[model samples]
Target: MKKIIFFHLLNDYSGSPKVLLQVIEAVAKKGFEAELYVGGGAEGGFLSSAPCVQKRYFYKRFENKYLTLLSYSLSQLILFIKLLRYRHASAIFYVNTLLPFGAALAGRVLGIQVIYHIHETSIRPRPLKLFLRWMVERCSSENIFVSHFLAKAESFTNIESRVIYNSIPQNMVSSGANHVYPYASGNKFNVLMICSLKAYKGVNEFVRIADLLSGQQDIEFNLVLGASDSEVDDFFSSVTLPDNLTIISRCKDVIPYYQRASVLLSLSKPEEWVETFGLTILEALSFGVPCIVPPVGGPVELVSEDKEGYLIDSNRVEDIAAKLAFLHKNPEVCFRLSEAARVKSLSFSVDNFESDVIEVFNGV
Candidate 1:
């Protein structure tokens, strides 16, 4: 491709946008002309600090769920119109996530190659999910899944698909290499979990585990969520947080947390939400921090059972608590897992991801 145009619905501090940012950086580094067409109101957000490139806004972000739906629908309509401007240009339309179907439709009509980077399978409203899948089969030329589990879960019969696992940003990988495990310093056992502000992500379960282990003064729980301060406060307004557990909202820099983390946890409820790929788990593992991932989905691929980490049911609060307590008491086992976790993370490097992206683009 001579040039590429990217589309994403939200530009918030989330996994999808961060992954997109890495793709853009990789493409741009190869001297390819790149431009972004994304939603507005991304000031101080993750994508707001994207590399030097022309950017256009189609819609604004909304807080309410219903308004978010209306806004995204309107954004798609606006995006369809905006994409029509590049009808004569030889640019690939790279749509991120399933929300930007209008870009795919416009690309189909414009006769431009469209590649969808599928990340999640937990889209709501069955009809919408089916409609997006149908759009992918009919409109897109190729689909790039973030994990093998996601590729299998959202298989398209006609469209060519490839599984490209997301990699940690280079900065994080370098930071992780030099990070010192806090447990070695005889610090409090810090169990860290960083994720979006979603109930299905098992925020309540993390807190419940913290409550269960509250009697252990040496263990501390840190929950870092991608949300505004007010949103975080509102989410826990009715719930009581244990003194040992600290809730950190809207964390921009998680390097410090990783440096101090004794063990990282991915407590996403499998039935409610099967994580396509847990970026936080990868990040934690890069820091030589053993992680506890859900028993299913892409996270299982990143973490090995009883090796890098355990694949446990997040819903099993007592079991998860027991595992955490075991890790705390058995420092030798935890250190072994921590070392293995770091080695496991090396395979998912950004260089490999960039090479894969180039391969996919060149093949097309």
Candidate 2:
């Protein structure tokens, strides 16, 4: 059966875009036809290479939040008409909750079926939450989540949502350059966190750790942070640590950073509902780098107390610093942990992601 997928935009300079691209390619390779509706992309959104995966730019640009939402609704209407011409396509796959509302509304008008996807750990807008729950209660048939943690974290009351971890293509895994170290250094260790430098991301925790280690006679702490270029300056302003701690902003490629780093550090606070699935931790492990994460949220799900890694029970600065010291102090333990990391990363393969999506569509 032909399947059409919809997305808000494809300007994927980030992790989510990459994951969506993988899913699109998976759908196309499985021989099910796919289509994408996107808004303004980043210098010609180069998200995929699937010929069967069609694309249509619904808007010239996405600016002014209110106007952008209006454009999305209009685009959905146009897409709905196009799909109405082909009633044989069994399912419509929507990428976000907001789009799903539009898809469900369109489905009702066109007598079509929809399968929605959930990716975030949580979202705000209290009324929208209520509206989404009400809509899902009436319109949704099947729903899929990126991680079980995300499904549990969402406030929307719903039936069982299948958990499908994001997978990287085995080819993308086995082939992509086996991490070449990028920085020139002496004995000082490289610490990396591949995430937007938002407050909740606990970037400050890295600062706190850096501050603790800054005066240590032996080591220089380098942090490579990949922030959005839009907020490059804002992210830069968030830094308050010493001169020894270096922060690189708006990097185009993070793979080299991950490769060069001795250990991946994720020290977000409270380990609350927001830290649902640790995609960054999985990516780090995929590169054979051991990760240190707080034990509360998604990181615990991804990184266990293996020989190479441990979860910090406290969000306190001292606890995080102690963990870092342990890893650096015992290089042998670090290498052993990395070996285990490579094994664990295998479970998040994109090939498996494709297979899972196909099975869901085929009702397996």
Candidate 3:
């Protein structure tokens, strides 16, 4: 059988890593042997336990952008030597992100096919984007994007490209009764924000919104960070949190939070960063929880304004507060949006994602 080697950039259980796991599972079901070549981190996280993963390899860190060209050259040289033993095997290199410039080079040198799966819409410095485009044009046999937003951003007009929307596994999708609104039972309405503590992710906006709505005793704000306790503490040292606001440093599983949330917020700053695709928004949708995202980037594609969720001006605290207040006041409208969100989420299923991936591999 043919061997498919995936070059992953991170060991964290984030969007890209989860996509890698899904791709590996998809390829395996198609009767191909799969292996993962991870960069930088240690061998524990979400990818370690994949039943479809035949073997795993950890390479030296190549994260510094200042030395990207040098790092790419060295990493490619190493990969070329390592893959020499599998030269005769029917194999392909599946590059998870643009960071692993080595995978394309190694595949080109080894006379193997390379598929570049792009999940980033924001690639800083025009030169880096140009370099990535040049590499993809020269090395990769196929390019797959997670959304049309990213595909359009890449502008790889000549290369063979496909936009395969990211998906969550059926088993992983949240199911059961949606959370009851606060006004109905004198309970606190839960407004949840689950994201990394980054400036571009609008962590400050979330805090600001929480402060703006602190006067409402019935509404409770919750923040689940992807950062450590100390990191969050250092970041939020100056900012004051309201009495109704609660912070959780991190969570191995976000399902419980999803189940508990009345509404999810992805107030990412469009000017600072372009979200390739908001996986958490979709996750919230699967749980019948509507989201409020900025009307930019991939989240725009996922949400329907005032239907599945609202796309508000994330910069204005008052605008966000209004939307939250609207949802809180109109429980019937909130319930309708919740049902609409679940319906919208059905289109992004793991089976569909896998099938699309398999078609790409088969075509290659």
Candidate 4:
């Protein structure tokens, strides 16, 4: 078996980096030898302190535009040379961003088989797309997508792409319903929305949903937010919530919050910017937390009407509020969605993810 390497070099603490890391960790635990190629030195970046991942050369906290580009090229060149020197003919490369034209050419020169892992709805044009297509279409390797929608978008590429959803472990999923008092009151159902307050994430509708569910005797909205940018963080810092809402920014383990919530609210607008595979929705569903998602995007692949979660017709606040009101008024529906959600989520366990990814790498 050829040794495998996973490649990514970004200072952003984003979901795709975490997904790549999860794949690396899963492969490592299975006793497979794999190297996680990530730059380090940035204090708050995704690659910093990633467990079971070996830090390569010059990962030291980079910013400044030119330096960032320089850092990217240098890191890949180093990784490419390292892979060639390792006596491995095949390598699995995971990329969240497009590379400079030079780096792509260097990888081909190194004779390393690269697997491009794309986890976003956004695409870069011009020389970037041309370079990426050349790398994938001409390289004769695998392309991994987090959702079918993403795979289909890249269908024009002659490269073979596969959709494998991100998975969470079954044991890590919360099994018991525990501790829900501090956030909610007397039979009020808990509605959870875990996302950064970005335009793409539709943060205002999250606020709107809370506003609609406001003053309800049987419902409270709990927000789990990560700071995407300083402006957004500042916006969240200044906001005041209604009496029916409780906003929590601290959650290292979201499964507990997932278990406590009666429903997960996804209010992201336009299928493209909002979601890729609905990873948060999967997390919620895994713990028997029913979800309410705006009818759009990759979430369509996961959410069905009254099944895993409710697919409300609109992103409008009234419709979302109306749905929440229904969930609150009829607790039976919540329980039913909860049960169904759990069953659906179990199919996406991390074990399944590991097996699928390994099989793809192994040509199984």
For each candidate, what is the lDDT? 0.88, 0.64, 0.79, 0.65
Q: Which candidate wins on TM-score?
A: 1
Better structure of 1 and 4 per lDDT? 1
Ranking by lDDT: 1, 3, 4, 2
Report the lDDT tens digits of candidate 1 across residue range 1-364: 5688888877777899999999988887888888887776545667777674756656765667788778878888888988888889998999999889999999999999999999989888778899998999888999999999999999998788999999989999999898866663447999999999999999999999999999999999999999989999888999988999998988899988898889899988888889999999999999999999998999989998999989998989999999999999999998899889989999899999999998877886
Alpha carbon deviation, residue 252, candidate 4 (Å): 1.4
The alpha-carbon RMSD values of the candidates against the true structure, listed in the order shown, are 1.4, 4.1, 3.0, 4.2
Native-structure RMSD, model 4: 4.2
TM-score to native of every candidate shown? 0.97, 0.80, 0.89, 0.80
lDDT (tens digit, per residue) of candidate 2 on 222-275: 555555456656655655667667677656556666666777787666633266
Model 4, 48-146: lDDT tens digits are 545555655554434365676567567656755655564445544444434422233445666655566777555433455666666666654567888
lDDT of 3 at 166: 95
Q: Top model by lDDT, which number?
A: 1
Q: Which of the two, 3 or 4, has more TM-score?
A: 3
Candidate 4: TM-score? 0.80
- TM-score of predicted model 3? 0.89
